[model samples]
Target chain A: MAFFILVIAALLVSVFFNSLGAVSLYRFPDVYTRLHGATKCTTFGTIFIAVAVVLYAVGRLLESGENRFWVLIIHTLVAMMVLLVTNATGAHAIARASHRSGLAPAKAVVDRLEESCSRGGASQ
Target chain B: MFIFFASFLMYLLLVWSGSGIPMIEVVIGLLMATVVTFAYKTWHPEKRLSKRGLDPRRWFGFVAYLFGPFALGLAKANIDVAKRVITGKIRPGIVKVTPALKSDVARTLLADSITLTPGTLTVDIDDAGAFYIHWLYVEDENPSEEQLYGNFAHWARRLAE
Candidate 1:
């Protein structure tokens, strides 16, 4: 019963964040805002999904006492670690490339990078 | 040598329990790992694993950081971003942050952590090791170091520098 509840909760959380991310992509005005919504919401949602998988694997291991379940848990964990690291790196790369391609923040008043760059390229 | 051993161990783990695999396959995997490691070393002869980064104490600090500040910051940033999405109120801006960490790896880790947190995205790193981050809500035109890093820099220094 507890396992079921945990699984349900994780599913709900992932669905909520994923839907929110989709909505944000539609709602936001500019590229950066949309990127923030798309990247963060999906990453958070995927983490919850991975957590659910881990919890399920652990529950199975406890019930079955099988070595393969242990392997499943460890592999799931390694996949989660890879996902977390790669997601962050990929988002950073995209944001950096977008900014370098001259996409300005829509509502920003003070452009610090521009200010510094104009001042003898202090922001290389 | 370290890279070779680590890669071999990783290849063994990838075989995973070795229940059904033949002994010949294991030997082939070992040979492949060795070849890959040799190729990597030949391609990057100047790249040596830094002793400080390999310290056990630094590994402990990194584990602590993943559980402590990084986790807390991730949760907080997620909530903050969620609220901003709901309210449709954001004051986005790019700001420069100069962390005290001198090591390139430490600075890269800090930048990656900041980028992973929902409300901030690392946009650029200058030659002086300063970060320009795109913050979802810029509270200050000129944020202090504490505001920028919030104990992350300290952890990065401990773990990598």
Candidate 2:
């Protein structure tokens, strides 16, 4: 009963964060802010979902003592790790590319990147 | 070589059945690992493979860092973003920081860590090894490495460099 409750709670958190990611897309004024919201929220939301899956797999393993449950648990862990790495890296690439393509962050307070770019030839 | 043993072990780990693994499966895993290592060596030729990752100390440090500071930062980051999402108050900007990270691996690890840490996102890493980060709330125009990324710089240097 406790395990079920924990799984449901994890799923609920996942759903909440995922919806926030979607809402931020429409709410944010610029690409960088939108990327921040979408990338971090979705990655965190997916982590909770993965946690719920791992918990379910663990419950099955303890109840049935089956070998396949071990595989499920391990694979879910591996998948979560892959998602974490890929999502962060992808966000970095997008930020770098957009900046290089001359997309300054909208409504930014201070733009040090612009200052550095204009100071001297900091080109590659 | 380190790659051979690592791949072989990984293959066995994936195929583990809790029940004792059969000898033929182990044999096949070895054969697959050999083919992979052969292909890898054939392409690289110069055996300049760094064996730093083979160290058990580094692996333990990395695991501890993952579950310790990194996990805490991840939770804090999500909550912070959530608060901003609800309130819609932000002071975003791209600020620069120059950490004395000599190795490419350390730079990469730091950039990725900063991205997932808090209100900071790594936008560009210049050829001169300085990082331009997109901070949701830029506290200072010229921020220190610690201010931008906390102790992640130390962890990155220790773990990767």
Candidate 3:
């Protein structure tokens, strides 16, 4: 029963965050802001899903008094780690490409990149 | 180094408490993870730190944004997609939704998020971080790229605000 509750909570949390990421994609004033919200929320949501699985496996392990819990927990954790690294790196690449492609912040008062590029041109 | 050790120790304690793992095993596990992290850092020393310095306050704001208005927007999108799917109202076209994000990290996040969702698939990303989206249902009205991205950008800023 407790395991069921945990699983349900995990699902709900994951869905909630996924929804949040989608909404933020719309609300964010600029691409960078959208990226920040989507990446962090999705990462956290996926982590919760893994945690739920771990909880279920651990419960089973305790009930059976077996060593299978280690397998589930460790493997799930490794998977989570892979997700963390890949998602983050992917986000970085997208942001870099976006910046290079000339998308400006909708409400920027300062233009540091513009200044630097102009400075480089003048130097040449 | 101190911060990393402290975090590892905290993780060790948590795992040991929850999993009923032996302290020695927990320590070993934590050590292994730390070693892996160190190896990754060594392999990519130049990319270790973010060009924009980390700020905790901004991070918290970003989290709050995700948990609030962003969620609302996703809910709406979900409903919209469901409606389109059920009604068979999808035109299904690939359209470019260019975002104005300055960071590669941010653009990747946006793209992945779009891909993960049901109705939209990210087909291609250009060098400038512009995403080509294949919508399951494109309305006959043919929404402009700016119009399409406008919804996403609004919620994204709120989520990361």
lDDT of each: 0.80, 0.89, 0.59
**What is candidate 1's lDDT per residue for B1-161, written digit by digit as tens?**
67777777776666675256568767987798889888998899888787665678877878888888888887777777788889999888888878867888888799879876758888878888778888888889889878865778887877787
Question: Candidate 3 chain B, which ten residues in sequence have the lowest lDDT sum?
Answer: B84-93
| TM match of model 1 to true structure | 0.93
C-alpha TM-score for every candidate: 0.93, 0.91, 0.50
lDDT of 2 by residue, A1-124 (tens): 6777888999999999999999999999999999889999999999999999999888887788998888889888989998999999999999988888999899998887788788874545
Could you tell me the lDDT of residue B92 within candidate 3?
42
Model 2 chain B: lowest-lDDT 10 consecutive positions: B47-56
Error of 3 at B40 (Å): 1.3
lDDT of 1 by residue, A17-60 (tens): 87888888988788777778887888888888988988887788
Pick the DockQ winner: 2
In candidate 2, stretches whose alpha carbon ends up further than 4 angstroms from where it belongs are: B17-47
Each candidate's fnat, listed in order, reads: 0.46, 0.70, 0.00
lDDT of 3 at A94: 76
DockQ of each candidate's interface versus the true one? 0.60, 0.68, 0.05
Residue by residue across B27-75, what tens digits does model 3's lDDT show? 6767876886787678877764452335676667666655564455454
Candidate 2: residue A100 lDDT (0-100): 82
- The predicted structure with the larger lDDT, 2 or 3, is 2
